[model samples]
Target: MTDNKQPASNVEDPAMPEDVTKESSQQHIAKDNAKTLKIRKVTNIILLVVCGLFVFHLIADRFIPITDLGRVRGFVVPITPQVSGEVIEISVIPNTLVQEGDVLAKINPIDYEIALQTAQQNVTQAGQNMGALSANVTASEAKVTSAKASLKNAQVQSKRIFAMADKGVMSQADADNARAELSSAEAGVASAQADLAKSKERLGSEGENNTNVKSALLALEQAKINLERTHIIAPTSGVAANFRLKEGVYAVAGQPIMTFISSEDVWIEASYRENSLGNMKAGDDVEFALDFAPGKVFKGKVAFIDYGIDWGQNEQSGKLAQASGQTGWLRQSQRFPVTITFDKEIAKGFKRVGGQADVIVYTDDSSIVNVFGKLWIRLISWLSYVR
Candidate 1:
């Protein structure tokens, strides 16, 4: 009875605690498996989404090409003076609009004017000299004709006197005198002819065709042209930019004094990756945004695609081709310029040459790609504000 009563604490089963510990470990393992499975599923989903986006971008890039490397371009003309002189007047203000043929500035025309006047006088004098030469030629011809007639008479008289002397019908002295007269007439004729030929040589061609007259006329024309060039007329309808010319400033011939940007020839130049230009062609629809006018998208069309680039172009130097090495795994893509012309007039005062821009071309009518391009360009336009 004593032993059974004392063993109450030891009566419990020893395997029960071990079983409980084993069950707890099993529960932890099950929980860990569940968590790992969940994490795997999440990672797979993320990777799938990323791959899908990459594929979509590739397809969009092929059909709907886009580029942030764009610029507004126009006829950027250098306002150079054709005549060198002191600037006497500036008719147009800096950055002001001017019409074609409008005078932008004036060079001192005094020297050119005096040159023109002198040229005119030279032309007049040449004409007068030509008239005198013609008269001299005519007088020489008349003298030659009179001498030839006298020579004919003298030849007949000499022949008659010689026949009479041979027949003994006239004195030998008379015959000798006749022969002397004939010789004198022949000499006169020869001198007159020489004078005529010399006069003709001096006259050259007649009237305006004369060499001296033509030279004078050319000088006069050049003088007139030089005088006209003193007035610097606008080459095209555009704005006179950076007009720093002032009165009394010396302007050198062919040296640019200012800049002229043509308004009518405004366009956009976009540089796209070479792979992106495969399907693009002229007349393709285009959308562009300029940094100067943020949040505004303008419509345009593809004017042309440049056929060549300067990169990797070697001049005609006789040397081995220099090939560049690529150290990185991925090679850089070459870019080409595509010209875009506006479909309509751009907003006034917004067109500026060399302005940064973004552009996109719609190569096909694929609604999905086009819609995405439209949205993407608009988004870029809005982002331009922050940029």
Candidate 2:
């Protein structure tokens, strides 16, 4: 029943070592293999950990963001020249507070005063000529009336002489003389009337004095303007600075001697990243801190956000480039400016033009899902899952 079969459990070890030296080498090899397995396990674990950290950083950068749009600074100005002359008086030094209409300096107004005098003389002369013309006109009227009376008297005499000659009471010679006298009187009256018309016309449309009067009036107005320009007054309430000018320093026409920055029209401009602005609005809370004046905080609401990158991309955007120079990839995260105005408290202390400040804006929509909250939640989840 068990023919030609070997017993399974009773078999002897076929590859048994015959010497002690051989058995020792085999045991050493077995030990080395175990150590290699441990070292490989440690290396693989380290690589996995480093890769995971890199992936986490890349994802986190997408959720949280920051930017700086640099500081903005400028000054105010009214660039019209009030007076045209050498500067005689400089009352305001650089960096002074000026109220509205305060005199900053004065020009040599002598020329303007002389101009006014000349204008006055012209008006006076024109007025005197007009007076003389009026007197002549009145005289001409009186002469005309007297001549008309004489003419009437002559006509009556001529009619009486003609009647007497027809009745043989006067000689023909006497009648002819009477007629000549009447003609002479009539001509005198007509001449006087013509003189009156000439005088009236001389005072009005045909007169030389009318042109003089108009010219004098224009000169007077110009003189007044020039005289008023003698006083250089501030156009706005502001802090004045940058005075490279002083008394007797000739400030040229339209040249800026100094600058004034208006305190009334002060506002802050803050720039935020384009990617981070998705949830921002005009009514979000904005907190600001000034670098110029530390420990001061200003509160404001978001005034507005810009439409797009105001400075457009290079001309290579939608065209084929022959050869492009170093127009690198635009930052996937771009920033646009946002304006924030100070609350009334800002006016109380540091309300000034060109004051610089750092700003932070937060939206109500970012309550639990925002960067801060989301990071805290993620930390907790990662800790739990890893454990």
Candidate 3:
């Protein structure tokens, strides 16, 4: 074809058009690159959001700490007998429920009864003695008055006799006799006055107000009190625990015979990390779970925070030692006790004192975090049933 036309290389190829193929390949590559870039940007934004949420959760948990370190606390009253006597009867058994003023036990009352009778008799005797003294005072006063009248008459007779003797109308012997009578009557009056004074002193301010009567009254009251104490009554409404009294065992004064776990009130004693107390305050909301009632969350409020703890206490030596220095690579956080009061009634028969519990505190701020915190406590409560 070169003799008259161009070579075969110069002929156009329809199957492999250069411009169309290049344009199509370039469009496919551009579309793939754009899709990849869009995917990468979405992945980065998702990762940033996830990381931010995790950091917020961590910070919230740190600020509002929760712990499983808690115990049920209430008043544990010791059943100490005020008076010493033999136990004759026991009305309640160990771990039995009792009410305030219910007789827990009875002591032998014969001795106390005898004491009361003796005290009464002494009081009566004192009253009688005081009455007699008052009567004696009245009698002595009357005698003093009569003796003074006699003394006055005797003195008048002596003066008249002396005047007659000086006028030669009466003998000196008569005047001397009259003077002796007057002196005797004066001595009698003085003696009667002394007796009256003695009687008045014995009578005191009045018969009932005498010192002896007052002392006897006090003794009588004490005896009555002792008699009443023979029946050991419950101090409050609660359950009696650790009771070991027998029918004839001697109950000593001021010695505890049993423990009364008072049901009048109950509370939670929770220990939290010291670092977590920066915002912890009374009246803050709290949630708790009891070992006795697992899977159940209880509501409460912070009642108080203990001012101190026995971290350095040495019970045997009766002194507190300095807090031990940080010894290891890891430092332990100090814990402080916080008292929480129940907002609602606990399950009946849930032994509160000394029972284990898990507690979490919710501060006043951050409602969103508090919602999550509440969810966590409920989860813990459910978990408590299993573990």
Candidate 4:
């Protein structure tokens, strides 16, 4: 026992014990560090995804669509009368639907029919006159032939008498008479040739723009116009608008007895914010919300964009300057108008008549960004739940 107690004074195996303890402590620390590093990596990845989504959402204005008035549109119509006549019957009323060539009114055909008959009579008379003229030309030619024969006989007689006079056997007066007759015959032949030329000119084909032919054609045209006027037809297929016409109403030339609105050419004119213009372009996908049907949404593409803003009567900001010589300033928003037309059957479902509509324009390209935004939203919602 005394000897064992004496070992306190002696040096123990310090290196061996110290090495074992240090090794055990280091192993524990390394295990803890590996776990901590794993947790930190997972947290960093989650944060990076969240940040990406946040950025995408902030810039989604380029991709996410906004609504505007740039999509509404319509068409214009000009009222025209096909013929001039008294209105006898009217078929379509105001706002009535009509197809192409549909009758709108009727005109009295009696006057036109009479005019046609008169024209026909005139044509026949002209033909008869031409025949008579031809016979006259033929007679003039015969006269020329007779004149030549007489002139030849007179010349022969003149030569014979001149020979006799030279020989002192005939008088000079007879020879002079024969010479005068021959001269007269030559003049007559010339007149006949002139007459023949005139006849040929009359028989020539009339050019399309010939004044006389045009006049005759105009007569035929008038007859045709009268016939067409007997039935007043719509120029195009559309709905009758502002029509005050009825049976027995007198219609004048260049007067609008009725108006027509196109049924199939309806469109939306939408006004978009200037700030929302960056992402919007022609042919962009769009959604429409009509003012009439608040719940219904229509689909269309951006058909057009205004080149500039138009601020009517009231001067508003960002209105494009009016063109030179434009009239009075009316109070209206000076915004660029865009045209949008619906192609789907859904637009038909809504009762739209010059209806007001708003549009959402889309302007972005990255699907990954959209996905990131979605994930971020989900994460935010989950975090809120956790909280």
Candidate 5:
């Protein structure tokens, strides 16, 4: 009774009770638990969505392969001269279209013309020499015939003279003279035969078959070819690019003076991950969007797939094979190139070589993944406008 009256601070207030404080703490904990549960549920939903997307991509990539690493490719032909000469005329303008056999340039044809004339004259002289050789051969044949007749007559005369001398009807001097004449006739025939062989050797076969005549004809033909080559013509239908040729410029043979981008053969080269090409094959349908022409999709078909890449190639440097070191836990996938040919002609102005593009291929016609691929490529086409 005395302590209660003395210490008012020791007494508990009705408004601040222990049970009430305990109840308030419990309420706060329940609210925190509810909030934590809600956060956990949201986190689970996000993880599930991400996993589902990853799985869908894996499945879709197999049937509908896509690649943003695509480029427009065309046959790049080097415009080079076959004969070195001063460029006298440039017939084509830079970045202009040309047809096959169109004159691209003209070299100094004066030297070639002179050479052609010289070749013609040489051919004529060869013909004259061949005719002379034929005449010599005929003359030698006639001489041989005459010598043979003389030899036969001398033989008969020598035999008659020897018989007369043996019967004492003719002098020994007469027999000796006849023998000398026979020997002379035989020498003449041998000389004529040797001359004939020499003439035949010089003449070879008659007419164009003669070695000298054939050589002259070949030289004339080569001169004509060189003269024609002076007028450089386009090898194929293409657009002339990187033109550096000008009048009076010394053009060297086998050196590229300009670049020719062939319009006849244009394709897309798409690089795809190695794992995504299992079902991909030539003749698959393809859709591509060029960076140059935004918001437009082009139709194409798979032309071919590259079988090999330059990586891991033996450079033949006579060194140890360099093992590429990888640091990460997951190795990076290798990419291979796939060629896609266009289904129709592209506008001549839009056909740029080495242009960028986004490409997708449909390996299966009935695959649902193709629907997504089609949508994705169109999306890429529209997106290209902003990029």
Candidate 6:
């Protein structure tokens, strides 16, 4: 009975058809094709994203300006003396703040004082000479007047003698003598006139306008200027640096005695690659950070861009340069300086001439690009601590 039951179960179970198997295989193939297409679409999307990022990077690099090659700069004034003298007293110390007109040092004023006195004496002597010349002129005029009176009297006598001689009342000898006297008086008057002209020439148009007086006046003015210069005063308000002057040190005229770094103003000079200045313009907003003061940002604006670079080359001198042979495929970019003036003075001790700094320029470009640039700048500023 068990064998019969097994045979009857086998008869009831039928084998699967070839068409069904084929249909199942076809469904598996379709599913595989759809999966492959979805994978390809995902790959294409990812590739597109990568290409977009690369293009954005290229654009940003060209448009957004940023540089870490920055240095603090300010006006450095060289203190020099206008007159040569031996320093008798030293006033200010090194690295000390001083105001304009503050005395820095003093020279031996004795010599200058003597010079002034000499000038004064010369002026006085010139005045006295001028007065004497005037007196001489007056004397000459008086002599001329006396000579004129004598001439008039001589002429009257000569006429009367001639008349008397002609009328037979006087001798010819007397007439001749009277004529000779008139001639002598005329000669005397001419001599006096000549002397008066000479005296007037010496006197000049005015007593003060005499050549000697004028020259002496100029010397007097120069002496006063030298006397004032003996006290070496500051030309501008600033911090005195490298003041190595000492008492008894002989200072030559126009020689720099010390350096005065102007504390009233300061600026930053940012050096950037030449190609990075295309979008930059004067008055563009700038942000900078000093390495000395970490995590602090400063505001500034582009003042000017230097028009030249010190590339160790000069204008063609007709001689060909000995060029070095090409060693590599890389070419270094040339840098240019850009001057940036601060919006306000930074805190004391934080400002240093030639201090290292990072700078970023905000151009009126795409706001999106600007946003990214600002973020990068802030990040760099924060990182200035470790760097």
Compared with the true structure, model 1 gives a TM-score of 0.83
With candidate 2 superimposed using the best TM-score fit, by how many Å does residue 366's alpha carbon deviate from the native? 12
User: For model 2, how does the per-residue alpha-carbon lDDT over 107-142 read when each residue is reduced to its tens digit?
Assistant: 888988999999999988888888898898999999
Evaluated with lDDT, which candidate comes out highest? 1
Candidate 2 is scored at a TM of 0.60
lDDT of each: 0.91, 0.70, 0.86, 0.66, 0.90, 0.86
Off by over 4 Å in 3: 1-54, 310-324, 327-330, 344-348
4 against 5, candidate with superior lDDT: 5
lDDT of 6 by residue, 195-298 (tens): 99999998986656789899999999999999999998877766788767788899999999888887658788999888888878899888888899888888
Q: Give lDDT for model 4.
A: 0.66
lDDT of 6 at 379: 85
Q: lDDT tens digits, residues 192-279, model 3?
A: 9999999998888775568999999999999999999999999988888977678989999999998899977878889887878877
Clashing residue pairs in candidate 2, if any?
Answer: none
In angstroms, what RMSD does candidate 1 have relative to the true structure?
5.9
The C-alpha local distance difference test score for the whole of candidate 3 amounts to 0.86
Tens digits of per-residue lDDT, candidate 4, 87-137, equal: 888788777668888987787778788889887676656556556666776
Q: After superposition, how far is residue 345 of candidate 5 from its true place, in Å?
A: 2.1
RMSD per candidate (Å) reads 5.9, 11.6, 7.2, 14.1, 6.7, 6.4
What value does the lDDT take at residue 250 in candidate 6? 95
lDDT of 1 by residue, 185-288 (tens): 99999999999999999999998899999999999999999999999998988899976677999999989999999987888899999999888999999888
